[model samples]
Target: MELNLKRQIGIFCVLLILPALCSAAFTKSRATFYSTSDGLGTPTGRCGYGDYGRTVHGGSVAGVSNLWRDGVGCGLCYQVRCTNPSLCNSNGAYLVVTDYGAGDRTDFIMSPAAFSSLGVNSTANDELRKLGTVDIEYQRISCSYPGQNIVIKIKESSTNPGYLSIVLFNVGGTCDVIAIQLSQSGSNTWVSLQRVDGAVFQISNPPSGTLRFRFQVNCGSGLEWRLPKNDIPANWRAGATYDTGIQF
Candidate 1:
């Protein structure tokens, strides 16, 4: 009977240790995400943060129904998975996550259905007024800029896929969609300035705050993206660059 008691104690001890071992293993197993080393996400827009080419899901790209919100069209959002899943309702209107915000949480934001319509991802069309935003609290903050005759260059990485807001400014005030141009080797290519009627352009970066802009080139797939300004800011970042991606 004592031997049996000892055996039972040994079994209990093993069971107790199993949970600890499993928990330790889980803690050690790190999820490979593309971002800064600090783990605090980008203060502003920065490119080459995540591997867009990689399959977010099992052997497939995580399809998002929408990205940007505001002044968008009305439609039913599809494929876009909600971190909360319930954040989206039956109505066509939902906040589309354009670029990843600077925060650490993974949330799916909705929009005024109108904002959803104009985006390239929008599909269904309905009454514009009915599709207005439901959740107004979750707004994205990122670096906005619009480039012009000023000579500049950005290097893109495989993780960058042009998901940012471009603005323009100097000592003067800044404007939205005022002007922007994307080129290859200082020459117009793929999406030349002439081809893109507007001044603003789309880029990949974090939301909120001022980021000293670092031009990203050929991010992984030979595309352009943005990176944190390794340098200091010239101004308080009074304004932003043009947003060409704001499809009229």
Candidate 2:
């Protein structure tokens, strides 16, 4: 009996520490920066964020390679800092994943502003820029968007009744939307939507009435389904945005 009790206690302690260890873990990788005239990321990014890509995390955005996870990694946030003591700062920069790219042995392709932010000073920043790519460590972090709820942007490619497409914006949280399903209002049958591009979901022959959305999210904790407070109107038009009134 004593041995069994001791083993149970040990297992409980391990469970308590595991979550913290997972959250604090960092990945070592190589990173490079892309240059734009305004020191910002491109609006026409691969993630389909459009002009909003230039504004997320105050223009501190990055294009990621394997981390893209086939577009499911879009809208995720990361805290990145270079390992170079001579040219880098300890604080580093927080960036949002807005595009998809890979460099020579690199995981993150950051914007100029985000890359420069890794430096200790202006002189250090200039030198770091010259290096083009640097050794770095990064960890996933929660995304925060103050006073902004997750909004669904209707893609221009969508047509009424025939096909529907959408991009989720302001997906603030530590979670990733791994899967999405939709159901017509007042119905119990749900239809799964396909992830076509980074941050883009589409389906053919959608239900006719107002639509409800549920997302499967993984946030270090197990995956959970998140329901939005609002539903897409029956007359939803292309290029119109619907406020889900929920974050994360």
Candidate 3:
């Protein structure tokens, strides 16, 4: 009876241990943010854990500002209001949140035609409009990075004060990097499927693609790690404020 009980107990242990190890091994899909200053990890949100479906877009085009603010084609889109009272004016418009925009400052893409619709074409108005740069304001992601040992840089993020963006990271070397639309490439309407932090992104290919890690952000902005890819200046320096590492 004692021997039989020991065998049964041993079987149970194997069942429990195997699944746990599997979870840990397979969990590499998630990203953990590590601090560059300290060796601590911050909490990266989970996948699909954010609202990319924000309702407001397009700041109301008016005055000389409207000449550049609402040029034309404004509907079912996004909005970028001026922080300065003298610039954006007192109204808002609806714009089609087109592809990736500027960067961490303004978080929307208002077509030039859209900016022209509001009337008033003055150089001062153009200057005022230029003050606001587009950025990613919403979305969430689990962060991870290679080395689980290196620290990542932190930055300010989010389009709205109430919500935060998303991000992910991974440890080790990266894989084949494919270039896509992180922002609007002139007249080209390239859309970004994901929001990224401006700090840096880390991807891992373990045992030669046996395992892949792509660190992502869940916030509303695109990441601009290098100057060459700084399509949107606003998205170049935004990210999660946490440390990353292996917990085990």
Per-residue alpha-carbon lDDT of candidate 2 for residues 132-230, written as tens digits (9 for 90 to 100): 899999976556665678899999999998999999998736578998999999899999999998999999999998999999998777999999999
Candidate 1 vs candidate 2: which has greater TM-score? 2
Lowest-sum lDDT 10-residue window in model 2? 1-10
Name the better of 2 and 3 by TM-score.
2
Number of the predicted model whose TM-score against the real structure is largest: 2
Q: Put the candidates in TM-score order, highest first.
A: 2, 3, 1
RMSD of 2: 8.7
lDDT of model number 3: 0.26
Pairs with backbone N, CA or C atoms under 3 Å apart (clashes), candidate 2: none
For model 1 the local lDDT of residue 155 reads 19
Query: How do all models score by TM-score?
Result: 0.19, 0.89, 0.22
What is the Cα-based lDDT of residue 30 in candidate 2?
A: 94
Candidate 3 lDDT, 1-248, residue by residue in tens? 00122232235347663232222122101111111122111122111112211211221111111111221111112222333344333222323321223333333334443343222335634754454342112211111221343223322444322323333222111111222222233433333323242212222211111111222321123532221211223232345433334211
Residue-level lDDT of model 1, residues 163-208, one tens digit each, is 4433221101111122233433223232322211111234443322
TM-score of 2: 0.89
